[model samples]
Target: MEKKLERIINNYLYEDIKEIQKSENLRNLGLDSMSSIELLISIETEFDIQIPDSYLVPGTFENFEKLKETIESILLP
Candidate 1:
């Protein structure tokens, strides 16, 4: 799941996956509002899960770990 998430995020980033720190802000890594939306769509499609409206916020996409946690919560719940 982590690898898949990284691959999806890599699609929108200029940096290599290895260079991205878990604590780094995705927005600073090149994810803008539009890309964030697209990223959400990609994640939903890939995971076969529809993220609730409540999860659609800046904080959800604030970093890789948070995004992973959000998806895992929905997927495992």
Candidate 2:
């Protein structure tokens, strides 16, 4: 799941991922509102899940791990 999430993020992020980690904040990775929206759309399309706007807060997308966890929670439960 982490790897897949990483791939999705990589498709949108322009930064070099050599030193990137799951714990790193996505905003720190240069994810502005535009890229964030793209990511949300990509996640929905890839996972076939609808993430409610209530879960679209900054904390949910704070990092790769957090985003992965949030998505898993929605999909698994």
Candidate 3:
């Protein structure tokens, strides 16, 4: 799951996936509002899950771990 998530994020980032730390801020890595939306769509499609509106926030996409946690919570819970 983490690897898939990394691949998804790598699509929008300029930096190499190997250089992106789980705690690193995605926005700083090139995730803007536009790319974020595309990223959300990609994730939903890839995971075949609808993210709740409550989870749609800047903080959810703040870093890799946060995004993974959000998806895991929705999928697991």
Clashing pairs in 2: none
Model 3 alpha-carbon drift over 4 Å, by segment: none
lDDT of each: 0.90, 0.83, 0.93
Off by over 4 Å in 1: none
lDDT of 1 by residue, 1-77 (tens): 99999999899877866686887898888899999989999999999999999999899999989999999999999
Best by lDDT: 3
Clashes of 3: 0
lDDT of 3: 0.93
lDDT of 2 by residue, 1-77 (tens): 66677778887666644357778888888888889999999999988999988999989878888888889999899
| lDDT at 12, model 2 | 67
Candidate 1's TM-score reads: 0.95
Rank order (by lDDT, best first):
3, 1, 2
- C-alpha lDDT of candidate 2 relative to the true structure: 0.83
For model 3 the local lDDT of residue 15 reads: 92
Local error of candidate 1 at residue 12 (angstroms): 0.9
Ranking by TM-score: 3, 1, 2
